[model samples]
Target chain A: MRWLRLGALLLVVGFLLGTAVWLRPFGSPTAFEMDDYFLKNAQVEAGANNVVTSVVFDYRGFDTLGEATVLLCAVVGVAFILRRVKP
Target chain B: MSVVVRTIARLLLPWVLAFGGYVIMHGHLTPGGGFQGGAVVASAVALVVIAFGAEGLKGQKNLFSFLEDLGAIAFVALAFLGIGSTFFRNVLAGGGGLFGTPVPFGPNPGWLNTGGTLPLMNWAVGLKVLAGLGSVVLLLALFGGKEDG
Candidate 1:
């Protein structure tokens, strides 16, 4: 069992290290046409200086809505589990 | 913990809260946004919990829940505002109304009055996140009937 665990850890570490070494250089994306379009037009179209904020709240608002819903559910779940009962 | 810790937490609380508000308010113009700012504010809650213990925050869970609900409702309502054109259209981007200032192209100082619904959404999300995470910490601290120094 100890040897199996050691081998598994080594395999995972080797895979992660190999993947990191083979990764692309920083600041150079594999695909950036969409990013280019956003950079060029986000300010004018969304009227926001921050492109990332524009993207999160304007261009991709549905995703934010979904994220908000998920947070709501989580809070509700926690409240339910921790509610105090009347004797 | 100690009196020193409590005093420091009290002194730093307002500054942390102000920074969080700044991050959320300037989300459309700055690197930080609603989520990041909310997390920062939530840290203040944790600090309070750690310094003063869960007993200090008794009976505040409902208030957090209410604020979270309010934030969620405000967010969805803002999204519904642009439903005339589309679900999430930038309807007020250049409308010259509330939060409707148009942004200039190229690099320049960012305006706070611009971004239309973006800033509103940032506030809504910030409120929600702060309330939710703060309440979570409070609840966890209050759980199991345990007390801390």
Candidate 2:
């Protein structure tokens, strides 16, 4: 039973790792490069000094907002959990 | 509470804060930014809390909360500025610079406060990080110990 569980866990991990390796979101483009687009538009559109910040905040502001929301949710979750326990 | 450790922490804390400030301000030109510098400053606070105990940071929880709120509000406000002109726009309304100077020249392509919302963002983040991390650690320290019933 323990061996079966271990094998199943290993199989799942292997499948997930293989999927991640095969699918690269930031991979090189076949035709046009995304970095060029980001660099060119970031300065004019975002008006940010840092390209990375522009990418994080302006170019993908919606995504960044979602990320911030995730952080907020995590903080709230921790607070809720801690509150339930006696101090 | 060892005297040597306390003395060392005292000596190092101010420098850490100053360097963190420098990193936050010069984030536009340099590699380090608001989050990195903020974490660095927070780590200094953590050091103080660890070496001196939670009592060292006592009575400052309110202040920390204020800083955290300020940072969050500033960030959100900057984002909302997009509704008018552009998101995170450098809309300083004219009088803008370090210590209210027009423009303090630094290196090329940017100034000390060249990045408009960027510096404000840095300040906000610094406060948030220092406060947020300090509070979390202090809370843990307060509740994690084996208290006599």
Candidate 3:
């Protein structure tokens, strides 16, 4: 069992190191066409100076909605669990 | 916890709140947005809780819950506003009305009166996050207590 664990750990480390060595260079992405479009047009279309906010609240508003829903659910769960019970 | 800690928290409360408001208000123009701002404000709540106690926020749980509900409703309503074109559409952008200023292409000083629905949504989400997180903390702190506090 000990030998098995050591071999598994070595395999994982070796795989991670190999992948890291072949990683892409910084500041360059494999696909940036969509990003370029957002950078250029987010301000004009969304009318927001911050492109990240435009993407979050305008282009991907549904995701924010979903996130809000999740937060609501979480709060509800906490409140329910923590509710005081009458004797 | 102590007098000094409580005093510091009291002094810092307004500044933290102001910074959080700034983040939410300038979500369209700056790096911080609704979620970040809301988290900032919620941190203020936590600071208060730590300095004082869970009982310090006694009787305020319902208010937080109500605010969270209001924020959720406002966010949905804002989304429905753009349903004429499409859900979450930028219908109010460049409309020359409230928060409807057209932004000039390329980088410049950011205008506040732009990103119509975006800013509204930012406010909505900010409220939701602050209330939600603050209430969560309050609930956890007050849990299993003698009373609701």
Which prediction has the highest TM-score against the true structure? 1
Worst lDDT window (10 residues) for model 3 chain B? B140-149
RMSD of each: 2.3, 4.6, 2.3
Model 3 C-alpha lDDT per residue in residues B1-149, reported as the tens digit of each score = 88999899989999999999999999888899999999999999999899999896979988898889899999999999988889989888989999999998998998889998999999999999999999998888888566653
Which one wins by TM-score: 1 or 3? 1
* Candidate 1, residue B74: how far the Cα is off, in Å: 0.4
Which lDDT values do the candidates have, in the order given? Answer: 0.90, 0.66, 0.91
Tens-digit lDDT track of model 2 for B61-145: 6887788788777778877866786565445423445322243222246545445455566666666666676667766665556
Model 2 spans with C-alpha error above 4 angstroms: A16-34, A44-48, A62-87, B85-110
Query: In model 1, what lDDT does residue A23 have?
Result: 96
| DockQ, candidate 3, vs. native dimer | 0.68
In model 1 chain B, where is the ten-residue run with the lowest total lDDT?
B140-149
Report the C-alpha displacement of residue A27, candidate 1, in angstroms.
3.1
Higher-scoring candidate on DockQ, 1 or 3: 3
Model 1 TM-score is 0.94
DockQ, per-model, please?
0.62, 0.23, 0.68
TM-score of each: 0.94, 0.75, 0.93
